[model samples]
Target: MSHNGVQTESQRTALVVVAHHRTDSLTAHIGRRTVAQLEAAGYRIDFLDLHAEGFDPRMNIEDQPDWGNREKPYSDEAQAHMQRVLAADIVVAVFPVYWMSVPAVLKGWIDRVWNYGFAYGRSKPRLAGKRMLWLGLGGIAGDDAALPAMQEALDGQLNAGIAYYCGFSHSMVGLLPDAEERPQRLDAAGNLNIGDAISGIERDDHYVEFDRKAAGFVEEFLAADRVPA
Candidate 1:
């Protein structure tokens, strides 16, 4: 692969999954940016726009796990998705943080595709040594008092509970708050507070900073792969 006119031997593939219904959403925009960055970094990108591809998150009988059979055959759709996962050296999931967690579609995608036999339920995990980055777009204000606790909760749920449990060598949750056009926060009494939306240069600057911060998260994630683990 070549990056910036420099030829290289690394040919890593990154499965960049975007779980947003609308193609014009901020989440989707960030997802596209992520793909571009990965490409520039010499990763062959297998971009999976779940909503556009009409991925049915609903679990069916064919995809259901049979605890007794660890090598059960899942639905064709599920198997196809699993193949993509298997082909990738790294996985980056970008989505809006709904209810302080991933959206229903993403959760269901995992429930169905990342099934017991495929992602887990074995002494030798298939996803072992793979890296994962979850870039969740959040609506909460950047300086909200609840931000720290929210980040901690998300880290525990996504990194510790799911990724590490599934045997991923490294997994990170890059929570990008201030995603909403109108700022939002929670008070000490747990009341929702919505602030005015910025316009003109303010809005432009806001998104500029947002993009920079988002890029920083992705860069940091990539840099970690170079370190000894």
Candidate 2:
């Protein structure tokens, strides 16, 4: 809670997971920007770069689900990851879209750390009050015909499939599009010509717009009503 009686970031920590292979990838760039924005909003951030940490996406027997044993201890790595989940008040994932869903590494993290007893298979959820936001970047244009389908698909997977199952109070997916825009376009004569995107100044302006859209998603998530069950 804050000095004004409203909940503030000082009292809440966000566990941010970035799933991308390269540190310099565009997905990682957006993830870093997100961390900066959240910090500027006063939230304490726990940044997890999965690839940099060398997290194994492969599952093993020790990490397998035990329906009868809610007390079954997972692998050492999984156990440590679970501890972080238990610690955070909010969770955020940043990744590139792969097959209209999360990458294998992120899904594997869920499969391993979000174990049966910890994330599900219990009467009361351990992550009951936590909230989540999934930031997915893709090369598809905003005006593309498949945009709605992509959005709906990602929403269902992140919000309904994972968040609800894990007992998150609220979950949202933000899709950042036009990631592969090119400056050259077909002219009236059907010949390619340099478009505004080729200009450095114009490209920067376009990115500013993209950043604004990305920030809007987080603003709404932060303002959401909290309904305790």
Candidate 3:
């Protein structure tokens, strides 16, 4: 169906799932900026603000018993969310690192959304051939010592747990970290000077051009065809 004037058939659809509890934080900024770039690139964007949408992180009481059950019943909303995940060619998860891992909301989103018979447990994954990006933000520096545990956790949790479990190739999993440390010059309203961050990372620009370039590489990787294994 064509929603928001976006053709679901012809145009490539990208779902940007932002899981930041705080709207005014750096996590939100990165989510918004990435969406802007993807939208500008002509991809149909579905900006899913999990917090704003009031998505209950905890599964419903009735559904709790079906945690690992293969025959679990999904509510209409849950079904729709899964459909969206299955429909998209690319899924972008944006959030902040909390305690060296994703915030509870994002983790819960995965727990509830990626269910049995959908994300895994069959001969193949339901979301196979799809791609994903794990875009993260945190106050910690990007040095090896500062983020060793975080990196390992992300690789295990996101890379192994979600992406690989769902049969998405390793090339499809991209990570962008330390968003808060990026040099940025923006007003109180988050109005960033486009040229500054887009110029160069070492430059006095407002945004982090290097980060953007890295994100672009991920986007391009997602759009590439999967080779036979």
Candidate 4:
């Protein structure tokens, strides 16, 4: 299909999910930057800000899945979200990392919207060919010794555990550490170390590099989707 001289399939759709209470947060900033980059790459953006959209992260009876029934009916809200997921060729989730995993909102989104009958439980999965990118913001310092382990664990959870289980064709977790203005790391004794908050040109430079790294990740994700036929 073509619109305004544009091929609808060529100009694919990207569903960008942002899970943050405040729009001014670094997670939200990265989410916006992601949207801009995808848009510049000619993707039609369906930006979903979970908090701003009043998405209920708490699962209710209506959305609960029946273990025996793969064709179970879900709540209207969950159905709507499923439609959004179905419409997009790619999904980009931007959220803060909590306890080395995605925040509750994003996790609940998976629980509710990515339900058994919809995102899984079928021989031919509905989301099989879709791609996903998890952009997680972490407060831990980039220099932290545990950073690599954290990344590995998160990848195992988000990529191997969730996305692949749901049959997504590709998924990548783009971790953005050092998102806090105050430097945070762990000591040799496994104690949390906190440094003084940064300001002035230093703070500006900090976020500039952060955004640049985030943009690089988004670019890489876009490139991955454009693989040769």
Candidate 5:
């Protein structure tokens, strides 16, 4: 297990799944920041840009759940994506919160790639030991009273529903709130109040902090694999 008197595991690889339609969006920026940090930490990054790669989020007849056969070969694209997922030690999905869950594209990717026999349904799951991080950015204000409820819903869906069911060893759901300061905010009476745009200085500060927060979560993920019982 040791090489040159140093212990090593498999060459660390991360499949970073980003679900954003625009490259200029804050969601994309978060994904980029995540990649930079992981690469700097010695991980070979497999960046899965669902939109940029033209991954279909729809489930055709060929992709329906098959309780009988887990190994039915799906579309070449799904199979190929599954291979990339298998090649990585960890998976980090960076996305904007959509209806308190993943975007359609990312959801579709999972529906197809993590199909039965592949991610689950076998006596022994194929994806039992890998780790995962669901990093989501939302436009809701960070201090909004509803943030906790949103986080809880996401935790149950992504962590409990998907990762746990798929047999991942560990999964972390890190929510980045206040990702967007919208152009308007509702008042106590629910009246829309036009909001001023963030000044250049404030915008710069916010993103710098956002980058730090993103890196912090990634670092925590990397450290966890080293902790001893």
Candidate 6:
């Protein structure tokens, strides 16, 4: 299952799911940038814009039943979304943090897509061996006061509860206050006025670095040849 002495094609595709309602923000730019980076790194990329795609995050009455033969029925739209997730070697979720959690659209995407049988609940999990990376944007500063709580939430609630529940190893990256706002250089006290700092950044290079970090993670994982633990 090797392609050019590396992982197979099936193992080099990364899914990029962006759950942003607003398209004009720096967060959206970062999301797009991430895709570009992974693509350039020779990994196939699948991008999902949950809102623009009209994804329904809410579960309906048909989802629950009592002791009967069950069918996992997804609309063509939903099936398309699920397939993208299924085919990926790695999954990247980019969204703005709201109230210390993912945006509703992203959360709903998880609730709907990561179903019982599809994402988990078999002797061998469906999403097993997959790795996940979370990219979050916060309106608050990236200091101890604002970041630690969010980091805990990501590690405990999202990573542990959601991703690890489905048998995926996870890593998270947070670009806070706005990617465009951070200072080009941090001060003596380690305080960064990110919004002011964004003005000096080279957007292209920034995206390149971000993508390299992400792709590097994927490459290391594949080289290790270990399933998700």
> lDDT tens string, model 2, 1-229?
1112245545677788999999988788888888877776667778899988999989899999988899899999999999888988888899989878999999999999999998988899999989999999877666666678889999999999999998998899999886654633334475645433444887788788877877887777776734334
Q: What is the lDDT, from 0 to 100, of the residue 120 in candidate 2?
A: 89
Tens digits of per-residue lDDT, candidate 4, 1-229, equal: 1112254656788899999999999888888888888877888888899998899989999889898998998998999999999988999999999999988988999999999889999999999999999999999999999899889989999999999999999999999999999999999999998999999999999889999999999889888888964
lDDT of each: 0.90, 0.82, 0.69, 0.90, 0.83, 0.67
Global lDDT for candidate 5?
0.83
The alpha-carbon deviation from the true structure for residue 28 of candidate 3, after best TM-score superposition, in angstroms, is 1.3
Steric clash pairs (candidate 3):
197-207
TM-score each candidate: 0.95, 0.86, 0.75, 0.95, 0.90, 0.72
Return the lDDT, model 4, position 100. 92
- Candidate 5 per-residue lDDT over residues 1-229, each given as its tens digit: 0112222475688889999999999899889888888877777788889999999988887777777877788788778988998888899999999867888889999998898878889778789899999999977677666679889999999899999999998999998876875543446686755566686889889878887888888888889966863
- Residues 73-113, candidate 1, lDDT per residue (tens digit)? 89899999999999888999999998888988999999998
* Clash count list over all predictions: 0, 0, 1, 0, 0, 6
TM-score pick, better of 2 and 5: 5
Tens-digit lDDT track of model 3 for 101-143: 7888888777778877668777867888777888766545444
Candidate 3, superposed: residue stretches over 4 Å from native: 1-8, 65-71, 170-220, 223-229
TM-score between candidate 4 and the true structure: 0.95
TM-score of 2: 0.86
| Lowest summed lDDT window (length 10), candidate 4 | 1-10
In model 1, the runs with Cα more than 4 Å from the true position are 1-9
Error of 4 at 72 (Å): 1.1
> Which residue pairs in candidate 5 collide?
none
